[model samples]
Target: MDWKLENIILGVTDVDRAKEFYTQSLGFHLDVDHQASDDFRVVQVTPVGSGCSVTFGVGLNGAEPGATKGLHLVVEDIEAAYAELEGRGVVSSGIQHFDVATGGMAPGVDPEHRDFMSYVYLNDPDGNSWHVQEAHHKGAEG
Candidate 1:
């Protein structure tokens, strides 16, 4: 059996603000924004090359606004991704890596740019955090 992940429902306080942030700032493709009534609204947006999408709007889920955290968006090039997001005016944390020995974050991407080692973080209007992780391995060494 093949199981595919589809939409992730994010509870945001404002629908229009979240839509703008995802569409304009993050460059996600706006898939849908439908409101049948004042109590029901659904907005879906997907990243450029992602199969999974995110949905947020009024009365969709009971989750609290800004409750989601640690969502990862894997990318092939950390530097390019960082530059693109920064150029688009998204406030992102400087690329950093986790130090296993000290269990702390170190400045800058991993020296070798190893897969899963480098990351840059950003937050949406509702404070839902997203991590752009470098997941491309150049070769056996990387």
Candidate 2:
């Protein structure tokens, strides 16, 4: 089956707030914003090179708009990407080493120690957690 993913819903408290965060902070491109009704609207955005887009609007089914921590996005170089993002003034937790028990590589083995890759955590405007990772075997497409 040739299935292409279209959108992933992102719950946000305010449409405008989420819009700005995706556009200005995460550098996602705004694809659509349409009012579905008097009380709701649909806004969609795509990361620069991602295959899928994220949508948000009023009263999305979930807790008030918030980011899910540890959502992983793979990159080629963790350190370089970290530096660039830091330069852009994005608050980062800095690159962290993870053990398999913490959802990393192997049990009791740190990714940083073995050089499998590196990772850093960041947040969107409303504290949605994001994990930026660089795999030693793959090159960054972004």
Candidate 3:
């Protein structure tokens, strides 16, 4: 069995705003924006160099305009990313740390990872939320 991460669904209050955010701020390329009905649109975006894609819209299987949460995007740099977002008028939700001692946000992020990692949250006008993560610790050696 080969299970692979395919797509993420990001529910946004406004499709245009979400499209602009993902494309302009996060550098995701718009793949598809299919309008299936008068009440909904299917907007998909793919990261510049990623096989995974995220889809957002409305009226998806009881998914209203706002019905997504806790979506994580693993990134390479946190500080530079913060600066870019700031330049684009986006605000951070404060720095979140991982507990190194317990592997659960130990008084800030682990020091071994250069202590340069953190997550800053942002929200759209309709309260749709997303965060930028600055570290990659998948195999326990990152």
Q: Top model by TM-score, which number?
A: 1
Poorly placed runs, candidate 1 (over 4 Å)? 137-140
Candidate with more favorable, higher TM-score: 1 or 3: 1
In model 2, residue pairs whose N, Cα or C atoms come closer than 3 Å (at least 3 residues apart or on different chains), thus clashing, are 12-65, 13-65, 67-128, 76-140
lDDT for position 135 in model 2? 66
Task: List, residue by residue over 1-104, the lDDT tens digit for candidate 2.
Answer: 89998678876777888798778766789999999796878888988788888888874565455645566776666667777777767787787756656575
Candidate 3 global TM-score: 0.70
TM-score of 1: 0.93
When 2 and 3 are scored with lDDT, the better candidate is: 2
TM-score of 2: 0.73
Models 1 onward score TM values of 0.93, 0.73, 0.70
> Which is the winner by TM-score between candidate 1 and candidate 2?
1
What is the number of residue pairs that collide in model 1? 0
Over the stretch 1-142, how does candidate 3's per-residue lDDT look in tens digits? 9898988776567788889888886678999989979887888999776778988887755345556655666666665666777777776565566665566543334455542356767765555567667666443346
Full ranking by TM-score: 1, 2, 3
- How many clashes (backbone atoms < 3 Å, residues ≥3 apart in a chain or on different chains) does model 2 have? 4
Backbone clashes in model 1, listed as residue pairs: none
Q: Write the per-residue lDDT of candidate 1 for residues 1-142, one digit (tens) a residue.
A: 9899988999899899999999999999999999999999999999999999999998886568999999999998888899999999999997898777788989887777777888999999989999999986465146
Backbone clashes under 3 angstroms, per model: 0, 4, 5
Highest lDDT: give the candidate number. 1
